[model samples]
Target: MFETSLSGLLTGRVALVTGAAGALGESICRALARAGAEVVGVDLVEGGACDFVADVATAEGNRLMVAEALRRHGRLDVLVLNAGVQFVAPIPEFPEEQWDRLMGVMVKGPFLAMKAAWAELTGRPASRVLITSSVSGMVAEPFKAAYVSAKHAVNGLTKVAALEGAPHGLTVNAVAPGWMSTPMVERQLPEQMALRGLTREQVLELLLDRQPVKRLIGTDEVAALFAFLASDLSSAVTGVCLPADLGTLAS
Candidate 1:
């Protein structure tokens, strides 16, 4: 267990994290909760310690999320638009359904969540919005066209929201993770390895080789970056997509 160092980082803030049931999402929730922020975790599947259930991609879901946030904490101070999906398929054979799913969760989800929470975020003090993007947004990856495109859109949304939030004292930014050890990657690893006719170990080796550190980035590491962005310490940082890719983006 990581001891909390976020004593007063977000002392009395309230946070809403979409896709909060996932490994990465849960980590971010834990980080914010430890920082003294009241966190409401939202996921389509729900469960866990999540305070609410909202789809985020649909108008109704978005509205429910905002309503739940207000009902739970009275005011929304942090918005973590982190709901997304990864579809592994080549461009030519990519499923249109997968593309729509990815876009809905990655791009549209954030837009809706931000839109629904706009008044609350802007009306609060020291409000922050953080999006969980990916290295794919900054670099190319094999068999993930939809995920890449959606991530790229996430950065665009981040920039636009940052600019809009600037005058209102709200900061918006993104943390782009590399190959992290999470269920999402593990599920795709076997299939991706089979596609390349390589063993699972070899596939991991291929991923690690791209990183100068030669290791997989941890979910907690990505969570730490989110923690930083959500804190007042990063008050001057916004409209930027910081890659936590273990140097993968450089190569």
Candidate 2:
């Protein structure tokens, strides 16, 4: 169990979070649980129910994730779409396989999950779909074509889902975080250094320099946004792309 602000913001609700094994996923799950919602954590890894263990990149996997949510909780109140990957390669050198792989997970994966959960999400009196996009989607960066493309698609999906979900008493929104200190970012450290031949600290410093706030985002902070949107507080707010990017985009 996770402890939160005791807002009781999501009391009696049930939430399903994909990519739950990851740092952001775990934080979101725990936060939802703490907010008084029973959470079903889904991932491609173990620890999450075996029934929920399916690749987000596959059709079968997306179906199973929704099925598991129904099995664990009769109704789904919130769907947190957070599963994604990052690959850094120059456009000229970018592997076709890598581009396809990233797009499949970051774009197609979330779309399938939303499609599978449509009935359940729409069935609920109040439902929400919160997708984790990135600043890369909003702004262009070097050597991140695949990642940027997928994120842009996610934003587009969020807008469409918002329009579709509104009639069903559901809201769809996205959070675009800049540089959160998560394992996702860490995973690219060595490759980043090798590519640029810069130290880890230097890489981080360069990233921070671009941020107007000059700080990395926190997982809990991102979770807090999800909690607010998933709850009644943001009922009227939908189809919005919120930047949790430490003012990076503002600059």
Candidate 3:
């Protein structure tokens, strides 16, 4: 419903977004493109918006994607580490493999991607590295130990990168969003219902209860925030995780 245009904000800039096949990642790619940035979308599987199909969890994949983006665009200005995966289970019953997989995709992926893009990003006058963190990064949630841990680590990585990038005119930051109306959240509903022994409606109510907004967040809402952070307007803002949690953090 937000109709404002962000055109011309990132003219001549090239942005690379991971998890480009997912709802949030695809939306971010579109948003950056709308802002006049040439976007290179990377994902494990091919999607309509994905320009490169690569697993973000591997160092080789990360390096390849960054190299491909630079090859095509000739310069990289924004690196958005938005790849993520979710597994829901009580900590006692959680599978160690799942935990490792989540960490690899979320935490390790971002770190490797950032490392791979560092030289190209720092070579520019003003570049940005944005990580997709979660409200779980700041707070805890049940049946999501891996997700929570990965997000927390991502926040820490963002701060460290911010400090190191400051002297090079590169900014690093993160966005922590609450529950959004996306396929990922939809998939969680069945797991949450079974875990809590509640109906789908009840599970929905439980999720909304944490936020005062009484509704799920829109992907575009979060993508717009990323666009702002990727632009010159947010040059002074770095080393912080901005929340788009619909008052969930406030309450």
Candidate 4:
């Protein structure tokens, strides 16, 4: 495990990460834990390594997450709005239910998560909120209307919340990742292959061709950014969407 010299940067703090069952989310939880934060991982399913179970798409579920965290850890210092699902389909043919599902989990979930916990975040000194956004938040792509729009909404939420939290010493920011090395991206590959009528290799190349870095960004790399945003080093940083993208937006 690669450790930063600034290990334990989040000592004496507590963090809550949603979507903690997924690959990227797990990486983020582990990163924050290693940085000395009492990481509380939340997810809906009963399995896959999260500390709590709560559906982020519902108001009640989000409220329970805060309650559970406080019940165990006493106070919240960092909140990572990371729970989400990926949808792939052409716009004209996209299902309304799928759109609602994506928006519910991606956009509304963050809003509810923040709403339920903002007071707790602002209650502590040097608290922070990090939203896991995507390059789609900044740019568009075929068959990604729902996911893109939801991410865009999150970026806006991050900015507005940053302004509101500034006077209270709470920092809010987002990280817009490019192609991530996660199961969600893996699952979408076959869909992309069929959608674009290309082979697996072709689909891979198509997805990566625009990224100047020429490779999928790993969950660990993205988690590192989350760790940084969660730590004291990022006390002055807020309301900005940092692209851990491989220059995807630059091109």
Best by lDDT: 3
Candidate 3 clashing pairs, residues 3+ apart or interchain: none
Candidate 3 accuracy as TM-score = 0.98
Query: Cα lDDT of all candidates, in order?
Result: 0.87, 0.86, 0.94, 0.91
List pairs with backbone clashes in candidate 2: none
Model 3 agreement with the true structure over 124-232: per-residue lDDT tens digits: 8789999999999999999999999999999999999999999999999999999998999999999999999999999999988989999999999999999999999
Distance from true location, Cα of 83 in model 1, Å: 1.1
Candidate 2's C-alpha lDDT?
0.86
Q: What residue runs in model 4 are displaced by over 4 Å at the alpha carbon?
A: none
**Candidate 2 lDDT by residue in tens digits, 1-251:** 12546369899898888888888888888778778898888788865322256798888888987888778778889998888788998899999999999999889998998999899899887899999999998988778889999999999999999999999999999989889988888888887888888999998888788798877788888888888888998999999989898888878
- The digit string of per-residue lDDT tens for model 1 on 118-192 reads 998998878999999988888778898899999988999999999999999999999999988889999999878
**Native-to-model Cα distance after best TM-score fit, residue 227 in candidate 4, in Å:** 0.8
Ten residues in a row with the worst lDDT in model 2?
45-54
lDDT of 4 by residue, 151-203 (tens): 99999999999999999999999999899888899999999999989999999
Q: What's the CA RMSD for each of the models?
A: 1.3, 2.1, 0.9, 1.0
Q: For candidate 3, which ten residues in a row score worst on lDDT?
A: 1-10
